[model samples]
Target chain A: MSLSVKHLLGIKELNLQDIEQIFQTADNFKKVLQRPIKKVPTLRDTTVANIFFENSTRTRLSFELAEKRLGADVVNFAASNSSVSKGETLIDTVNNILAMKVDMVVMRHSASGAPWFLAQHIDASIINAGDGINEHPTQALLDAFSMRERIGELKGKRITIIGDIMHSRVALSNIYCLAKLGAEVTVSGPPTLIPKHIASLGVKVEYNVKKALEWCDVANVLRIQLERQHKPLFSTLREYALYYGVNKSMLDSIKKKIVIMHPGPINRGVEINSDVADSKQSIILDQVENGVAIRMAVIYLLSGKREME
Target chain B: MKTLLNSGQLNITLQRLSHQLVENHLTFNDTVIIGIQPRGILLSDRIVKMVKKISGNQQLEYGKLDITFYRDDVASRDIQVPNDTNIPFSIEGKNVVLIDDVLHTGRTIRAAMDALLDFGRPKKVELLVLVDRRFSRELPVQPDYSGHTVDTILTQKVVVFWNEKDGKDEVILIDKL
Candidate 1:
C-alpha cells in the first residue's frame, strides 16, 4: 500500500499505518546500509532537488546521501548561492528548477508552511526537511526509529521530550509521532521555553527536569534555538543548564535508566551535558545512521507514485 | 487450472534437487546458497534443510536476498514491499547458487544477480528453480537445476505452494480467464 498523502508535511498529517509503513520500509533500508555496497538502483530514473532556504549540515547531507544511495540523481539548491538572494521569489526559483524535470523536492525553509506552499504550486512530491518550528518530519521519524531499535514497541511507552519545546520543530514533530504510535508523551523544560498550549497536544508538562527524567522510558532533548529567540526567555544559559540540563548526576538519581536523545547541533553542557550526550544510553549516532535510512524510505515511497503524463 | 506436480511428486523432486546440489557442490566448502526473498525463501529453506539432512553438513552457508531495490520497473509499476535480506556471511569468491520458486520472464533473477553482486564478487554463479516456464523468458536467463519445466503462453501463470507456508505441497498452472 502507498502513503495516503503524497507530501510528508508533518507527523500531524500521518496516520499510524503511514508511520508504521515508513518504519517497516526503513527496516529494509537499514539492512541495505549494513551491506558492503549499500547503494541501490531503485530510484535510478528519478531526479530529486534539495531546495534549502535555511542552513543545515546533518539533515541536508543525510538527505543527499539517502537519495544517492537509492541511485536518484540529486541537485542541491542552497538559498545563499542561488537567486533567492537576488530578490527571486520562492515560486520563481522552484518553478525554474521544476522546469528542469525534477521528480521530487526535499526542502528546508525558515518560514513555517513553506514546503506546504510549494506543494500547492508544484506537481512533484514534496518532503519537508524542516519548515520553521512547525515540523521536522524526517528527524522525528529517525528519532522514533532509533528509540524503537533500542527499546521495543513504542505503544504504551513513556517518552519525555526535554528542553526547548516552543522553538523546536523536532519537538513538535516528535510529540505528534509518539502520540500517534500510542506512546505517552511529556514535554519538559523552563516554563518560558515550553509552549503554553503544549498540554493541549495530550502530553504532560514537567517544570522539574529530574521528575520528567524519572517518569519516562526515553528523554528526547531538543537544542535551544538561540537564533529563533527574539528576547531573553531565560535569565541566562547557565541558569537554564543548572535547572533543566540533563547531566550524569541527574540521570544517576533516576531509579531506572532513561534513554537520552538529541536532535543535534547540540548545545553541549546546556540542554544535555557532554558526559550525558556521550553516555552509553544515548542512541545519538544510531539516530544519525537511521536518518539516512528513514529519508531513503520516505523518498523511495514518495517516488513510487507514478509521474503525471 | 492444471496440476503440474502433486504433493508426492513435489516431495521427490525436491529430494532429487537437493541431492543434485550436493553432487555439484560437495561439502559446500566454498559454495553458498542464496534464496530470493518472499517466495523463493520457502523453496530454499526446504532445500537447505534437506541438503543438510543428506550431506550431514549443518554449517552450510545459506542466505535470503531481497531484490525489490534492484527492480527495473520500480517507478513504472506498482510499488512492491521489500522483505528482510539476511546474508550473514560474505559471498566473495564463493560458488553461489541462487534459488527461486519460479523462473518466468527471468527479470527477477536478473535483479537478484544485481543485488547479489553488491555483496562482493563471486567466483561463479548458478541458478536453481522449482519450476521453469521454458518459453517466456524476456532475458537470457536459464536455470542450471530445475525441478520441472513447463511450456506455456505469455498470459499464463505458474504457482508453487509449499506445505510449510500454504498448507500444501503442489504446483499449478493458471491460464488467463
Candidate 2:
C-alpha cells in the first residue's frame, strides 16, 4: 500500500498506516544498502533539489546520499551562498529551481512552517527536513525505527525525551510519531527548558533526570539548541550537565538497561556524557544509518505519487 | 478461459523438469537456484524441493530475487513494492538457474539478470519456466528448461495458479475481450 499523503510535511498529517508503509519500505532499502552494488535505478528518470535555508550536516548529507543511491539527479542549494542573501523571495527562488525540471524538494528552513508555505505554492512534492522549533519528521521516524530495531514493537513502550524540549523540532515530531504508534512518551528536562502546557500533547513531564531515566525503556536525549536561544533559559551548560545531563552512572543506577539515542552534533559533555553516548546502550550511530534508509523510503513513496497524477 | 494443464499434469511436468535439472547440474555442487519474485517463486519453490530431493544434497544454494528496482517501467506504471531478496550466498563463479512461472516478454528476464549481476559475476546463467508463451517474446530470450510451450496472441494472457496461493494447481489462458 502507498502512503496516505502526497507530501511528508509533518507527522501531524500522517496516519498510522502511512508510518507503517514507510517503515516497510525502509526495510527493503536497508537490505539494498547491504549488497555489493548498493545503488538502485528506481528513480533514474527523476530529479530532486535539496534546499537548506538552515545549516545541517547529518540530515542534508543523508538526503543527498539517498537520492544518489536511488539514481536521482540531485542539485543542492545552500541559503548562505544563494540568492536569498540578495533579498530574493522564497517563491522566486523555488520557481527558478522548478524551471530546471526538479520533481521534488527536500527543504530545511529557519522559519517555522516554511515547508508548509512552500508546498502551497509549488508543484513539486515537499519533504520538511527541519523548521524553526516546529518538527523534524524524518528524525523522529529514524528514531522510532532505531528503537523498533532494538526493542520489538513500540506499543506501550516507555520513551523519555530528555533535554531542550522547548527548542527542539525533533521533540515535537517524536511526540506526534510515538503517540500514533501507541507508545507512552515522557518529556524530561529542566523546568525552564521545558514548555509549559506540554501535557496538552498527552505526555508526562519530568523535571528530575534520574527519575525520568528510571521510568522509561528508551531515553532519546536531544541536543541543547544554544543557537536557537535568544534569551537565557537555563542558567549554564555546566549546571545543566550537572542536573539534567544523562551520564553512565545515572543509567547504571537504573534497575535495567535502557536504549540511549541522540539526533547528533551532540554537545558531548553537556546534554549527554561522552561515556554514555558511546556506551553499549547508545544507538546514536544506528540512528544515522537508518536516516538514509528512511529518507530513501520517503523519497520513493512520494515519487510514486507522480505516476498517479 | 481454457485449461492448459490441470493439477495431475502440473505434477508430472514439475517432476520431469526437476529430473532434467539434476541431469545437467549433477549434485548441484556449483549451481545455485534462484526464484524470481511475485509469481515465479511458486514454480521455483517446487522445482528447488524436487531438485534437492533427487540430488540428495540438502545444502544446495538457493535464493529469491526481486527485480523491482531494476525495472525499466517504474515511473510509467503502478508502484510495485519489492519482495525480499534473500541471496545469502555469493553467486561468484557459479551457475545460476533463474526460475519463473511464465516467460512472455523477456523484459523481466533482462531486468532479473541485471539484478543478479549486482551480487557477483556468475559463470553461467540459464532460465527455467513452467510455461513458455512462445511467440509473444519482445526480446530474443528463451528458457533452457520449459515445462510447457504455447503460441499466443498479444491480447491473450497466461496465468498459473498454485494451491498455496490460489487454492489450486493449474494453468489457464484467458482472452482479454
Candidate 3:
C-alpha cells in the first residue's frame, strides 16, 4: 500500500509518485479554468485557515484564490493583525484556530520549519506556504509544472538557478523538485551565498554566471541579496548585476530555446535585464497562472475526503 | 446474476474493450490519459499499454485520479478512505481520456470530471470504461466507449480486480450480504 500524506509540510515527505499525483490532479483542475464558472464544489464546507506569520501578497492571495475556487470556506489570519503581538505563541494561536474545527491550515512563518513543527502537533492538514528560507514545496511544484508545460519534459534538461542560493527558499525547493523530476540542476552565485555542500543534494554549484548560462536549458535568475546586503555578503548590487545578472548579452550566448524564469517581485535591473524579463522566452507570468492551479491541486488532495465519485 | 458474468468473462471483455479503444481513435494527438481511482486506474493502465502497443509509441503519459473530494456521496459516507491520485504528467492543452472500470449511476464520472477541471484545461476529454452496467443514472452522463454493458439489479455489486489489487484481472458480481 502507498503511504498517503495528510499534511504537505515539506517536499521531503513526498516521493516521485506523490509529486506526480499532485501534478496530475493539477492537470485535471486546469480544465475547470476554461469553464464559465471556474469554481468546483469539491471542498464545500471545508474550512481552510491561511495563517501567514510573514507579510506576503502573492503567496497568500494565491492560496486564498485556490481555496475559494475549490468551494472551501477561507479564513485569513495575518500574524501582524492577530493576537501574536499580544504575547501569544505560534502554538497557542494555531491551537485556538484548530479548536474552531478548521479542516486545514496553510501557514507561512519567518521561522524555519514552523510548518513541520505544527504538523507534529496538529490533526488538521498542514500546507507550508513558506517557512523562512527552509522550504516552499508548492512553489517548487508550480515551477516544475510550468517548466513541464513549456519544455515538454524535465528529463536530462539543464536548469541553472542563479542568484542568492543561500537565502532563497525558491532556490532550495527548486533544487529538490528539479532533481526529483530528473533535471540536471546547477546553482550559481557569489561563493559566499552558493554553499559548497549544496552539491550533496544532487545540484552542481557554479560561481561564474556566464559558464552556468552556457550550460543551461533554463536560467532561473533569483532576486539579489538586498535583504542581506548590510551583512557585507557582496560588494554592491551593481557588481552583482555585472557579474551575475542575466543581461541581454548573457541570454544571447545561450541557446535560443533557453527559457528564463523568476519567482516574482523581480528586481528588474538587478538579477535580470529588463529586456530579458520582457523577452519571448521569459515564463514569469506563466508561473503565476500555474501557481493557482498547483495550489488548488494541493488543497484538494490534502482535504482527505475520499468518497467514490 | 452472480453467475451471468463471471471473473474470467470480465477479463475477456476488458481485453476486447482495449482493442476497441485502439480502433476508435479515441486518443489525443498529444495524448495524456488519466484513470479515475481504484478500478478505473487499473483498467486505464491496461488500456495504456494496449494503446501504446497499437500506436507503436512509448511516449504516452498516464495518470490516476481519486475523485474522493469531488464525490456526491461525501455527505452520506461516514468513513472515507484516502488513496493516492497519481498523475505525473501535465494535462494542459493535451487530449485527456478519463478511464474507469465501471460506469454505473454516473455520479463517479461527474465527480471525476469536477476533479479533472481543477488541474488544467485539456484540449478535449473522452470517457472510456470497461463496464457500463445499465442502471438508472441520476446524471446525464454516457461513456464515449464501453467494453461491456450488463443489465443488472441495483443491489448487485460489480467488483473489478486487477493484478495490482488482486492476483489477477477479473470482474465478479457479488450479491449483497
Which numbered prediction scores highest in lDDT against the true structure? Answer: 2
lDDT of 1 by residue, A1-309 (tens): 778778889999999999999999999999889877899999999999999999999999999999999999999999998888889999999999989999999999999989889888888899999999899999999999999999999999999998889999999999999999899998899999888888899999989989888999999998989999999999999999999999999999888988999989899988999899999999899899999999999998888785522
- Interface RMSD per candidate (angstroms): 1.5, 1.4, 7.4
- Superior by TM-score: candidate 1 or candidate 3: 1
TM-score of chain A of each: 0.99, 0.99, 0.95
Alpha-carbon runs more than 4 Å astray in model 3:
A1-3, A228-230, A305-309, B5-69, B73-156, B159-172, B175-177
After aligning candidate 1 to the native by TM-score, how far in Å is the CA of B56 from where it should be? 2.2
> What DockQ does each listed candidate score?
0.65, 0.62, 0.11
Off by more than 4 A, model 2: none
TM match of model 2 to true structure: 0.98
Ranking of models by lDDT: 2, 1, 3
lDDT of 3 by residue, B1-177 (tens): 254345677667766766776665544357778998776777887788878877666777888887865776543454243456666767788778899987889999988887787777888889998778876577899988887777867877777767787986667677785
Give the DockQ-based CAPRI class for model 2.
medium
lDDT of 3 by residue, A1-309 (tens): 121677787787788887887887787667656555688787787899999988788899999999998889999999888789999998899999989988889999988899888878877889999888889899999999999999888989999999999888889899888888899999999998886699899899888988998888888888864664458888888888888888887778766568889987799888998999999989998898889989988887766533222
- How much of the true A–B contact set does each candidate keep? 0.63, 0.47, 0.08
Where model 1 places Cα greater than 4 Å from the true spot, the runs are none
Which residue pairs come into collision in candidate 1?
A: none
Pick out the ten consecutive residues of candidate 3 chain A with the lowest summed lDDT: A300-309
Please state the i-RMS of candidate 3.
Answer: 7.4
Q: In angstroms, how far off is B33's CA in candidate 1?
A: 0.9
